[model samples]
Target chain A: MPDGFDQFVTDRLDRLLRYATAMTCDRYLAQDIVQEALLRAQRRWGRIGAMDAPYLYVQRMVTNEYLSWWRRRASRDVASPATTIAALTPPVGDPAVHHAERDAMRARIAQLPRKQRAALVLRYYEDRSDAEIAEVLKCTAGTVRSHISRALKTLRADNRVMEVL
Target chain B: MTNDEMLIREAIGEEAGQAVDPGTVLAALHGGRKPRRSRGLAVAIAGVAVTAGIAGVMIPLTASRGDEAGPAAANAATGAQGEQTILVLGLDKLVDEGQRPDSIMLLRAGADGSFRALSVPRDSRIDPESKLNMAYLKAGGGDKGAQATAAEVEKLTGVRAQHYVTVAMTDFPELSTAVGGVEVCLKKAVNDQLSGANLPAGKQTVSGEQALAFLRQRRGLPNGDLDRIARHQAFLRGLAARLATLEPAKLTALVDTVKRTVHTDAALDVLGLARRLTSQSGLTAATIPTDGSVDTPSAGQALAVDPVKVRKFTTEFFGNGPAPAGGGAPNGTDTRTPCVN
Candidate 1:
């Protein structure tokens, strides 16, 4: 409950949650992961808050939480495939036609391997550069680029099948 | 951006755009832990702080005398300037014949937070009449056991430990479960009835009671207690790898379990140890130097180790001096779960 930590939570909690949601594709898991990350961040905020980008450190924590083996094993069945469908379900009575392509894209994004999907989400959704994505992913910039490239290749392959259909 | 990129961004943005409940996060942040505060006001203030959104400034009240460290220093300052040497003892279960210290480890943490552990084989001769393991039973068996063992260790190695941590082998199950078990590799299948271990060769994750058995089996090992020491080192290495990769939530749970399970000296600084565990600073482990097997009148078969060689190995390995250039199983930061006998 230090001033810097509270202020950080007040300002960036929403954004962190959004990023987590995109990465996890499960709102509840996102909430849990973001809360856990922030809890840890606050514990050492005296050091983290002194960093150049405190949010980035917390963001990396959130990413790591989502990528953790236990988290994946626990949330694999409950989230992603099921909750993502629920979230992507077009709202009743709205024009659901134009959303079909975007919905398909979202589904494909969720189907990517967790790391590649993570790289895609960080690069496209968070508007982070490849270097920032590498830092968050704890990989080289070349590795991050490869992840993004491979993910884009998979999504494009799926799109080609859709075009043929 | 191209059309596909635009569609990807829009899809991700739309998928992620949802209102997050801020209350839950604030609750977790404010009400996360009470052990960091004084016992008297922990419950009363935690609830009020969570509900009212008002909490006191982060204070390192327990940081006195280097017992604990402030949050800022917990990472950057504590290990950056000073090192800590801890004597880690694993105690066996009590039966009709009383108990003995199962394993002894000399953990020396450097100023950079990296640690090197020296495992003293339990069968090493402390004197012509007594083995190293007998030191604990010679004295009364609780805290005195740790002190007696530390004294023996200091006499043998000429290095005094700043603190001691003792864990009952009975707690290994819960401790292993807390970290989701640890993966260990076996060079050959084990079927030792004395230790209740029936494990196959190669790498596998052991938890709960199986983990206890895995660490306890020594009868069938080619080197006996020496091989068991290797098993201990392998388990510690696997545990360290697991802990290093654990996320914050699991790390917190593991830390809580450790606080509840392990008994340490008041000045050991558990949080500081946790910080070191979390840091990327690696671990180097080796066993104390030994000559050969000896049939002792007091402790039966024991390893014949000279105290002079033991002190030299400790000084060279734990000291800033170069590691003893020779044949000791000194593995530095390999991070592999070594296949052990």
Candidate 2:
């Protein structure tokens, strides 16, 4: 209803959705996550505006909300090894081959534990500092570094991801 | 930390470039419904009968009638001068048999531009055998609760609470919807029968009633009130992020919403000051370090408020220094008040 809210939604919606997608590894669920995060922010605009980095705050919310959802659902077996690599392959290739490689990288990143994935996402995707990641995760900077270290190790071990990178 | 890591970070940043529209997200958060309590609701709720009952229950006590007319002086003296400390209190456990504070948080913005929130347990016992919820109730309810709670908090912590803001339960849904929705992480499925918040675990966006249910559901929580406080803090953090990305119109609508629902002694001019103080500051939220619970002789089992420990917490948070300019004398300020219906 306000003037800039619509524009704000339009401008940042895609990026937030991508963040959700990367976090959940599911486009539909990612869309839902972004939407919910935005709505919550809208309702508390007054108090939110009073904060320092409102975007980071919302991103943390989305991640935390996503984790809460994960906690509720029964854990499924990790996607089969065969399916995992296939899922990471980009659908559209040709001139956008680079985009496909990036997509595959994102898929690999999503397979990490929620916290690890979040650490990687914030560190690389959002380009946040270790301290910033710690703030969002409510952990110490050491914890964030450990998450990154472990996440990197996992990514390195995944031969397919290594090649893509 | 390495070049490879930096490359990965660039890729991730590129991926984040493709954010989704928040409008749809906002709709989903509100469960795809428009705000129910519009201007009409405010008008209807303001009628004589409602006012009479609220007034009767929430009359302020004239304990120390000092300078009530010097809010301007208080602002001028307190603004960005020296070592400033804000006291943030969250009223998570203040449930009165059936009623709850929804969520109450206090933030002490220091002069160094760092802010910390001191979460006051709702169940924590105060003087006169009242729980933490009464502080807000005594402050005339709604936004007044923050004011009353802040006043009492200053007494307990020996910190000057210069500004206060209070938001109601209904604001949760509207805000969630407006920002699209909020994403929260749960360790496992939460089917809170008490609050009626049923959800599968993992990352998910919740709508109107669901958001309220999530914040209000303490019985099903592992640590009960403690977990609830964590959730409230997480939600506040998420809400702050969503607010940063709003467009002009949505920002205006949000401001209008604040004008309607949020009650603060902070004037329009103080808005900029508050914003500056909070922005770029490390906002730390900590529960009032106490021994959790205390057994009272008259009041069976209650959450204990350790004045000595709380005093220490105040000192650490606000920096044990000279009181802010215009701050009244440190002694005789009573922060404990009972909220009895």
Candidate 3:
């Protein structure tokens, strides 16, 4: 009974954390949201564990947790030692200019609406197909495409503004 | 596809790569208990002991289990063998208004030294026209306010609070600085004039004025006051952890801050409770489950909390069951402090 759930956590916990971290842009929040989602999944493991792609359904939970976190107040609030954008600072050896560009781009992505940001992260960060992204976002594939396009359009416009500056 | 997309991918990769392993989470999962977070968070979970210690007053008792032996235990019972529940409040210092409790928590300290804390959001609906925070104001603030809030908590949770404790929000700065500083992280950089917060995105130690700003900034947060509450919880966790290991001289200063800022009922033994909590682990902190937000006629917008659910949750939490299932470790167990938005 418990083996499936434990195995699932062992197999997918890190990946889920990574997906959550990418989506939320906050590793601590990602860990928390992922843990919350997984705990909920574990509670109903009898049902969720039987599904074909439990990981996919669990991913949906993580996505919804990220979107609804601001809407529904998160319950457990603990202080993590390394928080915020500082964790996003690229590995030490990148060129100074490259680091600045990456930081600037990350800030721009953070500014996108949560859904659009999720779409971009799904496509670019996770390399997920539109159908897979749709399943997680609970939107149709067409909406997924539109989300990515609209996000890109905004990024392009912001990029031009930065260039002009 | 585009240069911008490539940049976005690279940025997301760098951030995602920072995701840490779920070692602590797994440990708790296997233990069938809440993760034992840092000594600081244990202090937050053990709300009364640490806060009262910092406030330099009686550590307010928690849990309605006082129904069984709480009242007697709170007042004269010297043997700390049974579970005790205490209502703890943090009062916000308003300029024109007297004061209102921004944080309301029911903390239960078990005989074994384990603790459970349940935080009721300030905006939780007490009635159709009023919120939980208003209970304090309606009761004319101060000790009376603590009584009113305690009564409301009792009514909501179906348990009686044997003892109550109150802390001033203004004292947070001094209390925070007294322990050197409380470290906090923000997901995004913020510059809010309303709360006097001007900080860059990253992990940094905050003290004095900055600490107050970090706790008070709600205007620009994504979840408004709820987010602010999270900040306060995290800060308390960090502060409590520090208080747990404070040196004798620094502890003396903290006690002075606590004395001026904290108010409790006459019965509680502050130092005794502090000693029990500081040396223990197994603390779990949770917020009352809320069903989104609603626009109230009297209050602008309030958290639509179901009293039934709240009571049920508390019953199960404070009840005799072996902790709630899937109890993730309370926060701050990780060596790294989590960054918040």
| lDDT tens digits, residue span A111-158, model 2 | 577899888887766678999999988999999999989998887677
Off by over 4 Å in 3: A1-165, B1-79, B94-97, B281-283, B316-336
Top-scoring candidate (TM-score): 1
Q: Each prediction's TM-score against the native?
A: 0.50, 0.43, 0.49
Which lDDT values do the candidates have, in the order given?
Answer: 0.65, 0.51, 0.64
Give lDDT tens digits, candidate 2, residues B1-341.
Answer: 76456547655665455444555555654464333323223222111111111111111000000111222224323445443333222222211122234333445545665544556666667775766656766654434555566666666666666654433232445656766765565657878676777978766666566766666666866566766665655454444434434443453344323322322343312222332343234434445654556676765566767777777765664552432222111211121110100
lDDT of 3 by residue, B123-212 (tens): 888889988889887876655777788898888777787777665443455566778987777888999997788989988888877877
Off by over 4 Å in 2: A1-165, B1-103, B136-148, B266-269, B274-282, B295-301, B318-341
Give the interface RMSD values of the models in order.
Answer: 18.9, 21.3, 16.2
Q: Across residues B1-341, which tens digit of lDDT does each residue of candidate 1 receive?
A: 78899989998998798535767666656777422122212111111110000000000111111122222333333434377787776655421135566677777777665767788877788888788879877886555767788999999989888877654432346667777888889889988787778998999998876776787676877777777777777777777666556554454443323322244555555444433333365666778889888888857888788888888888899875544654245655664776888
Q: On TM-score, who's better, 1 or 3? A: 1
Clashing pairs in 1: none
DockQ of each: 0.12, 0.09, 0.12
Error of 2 at A66 (Å): 43
Model 2: DockQ against the native?
0.09
The superposed Cα distance between candidate 3 and the true structure at residue A163, in angstroms, equals 82
In terms of docking quality, how is candidate 1 classified? incorrect
Report the C-alpha lDDT of model 3 over A1-165, residue by residue, as the tens digit: 658999899899888888887787666557667877787888999999899989999999999977875332212111111111222222245577677677767766765777998898888977999999999999999999999999989988877876664
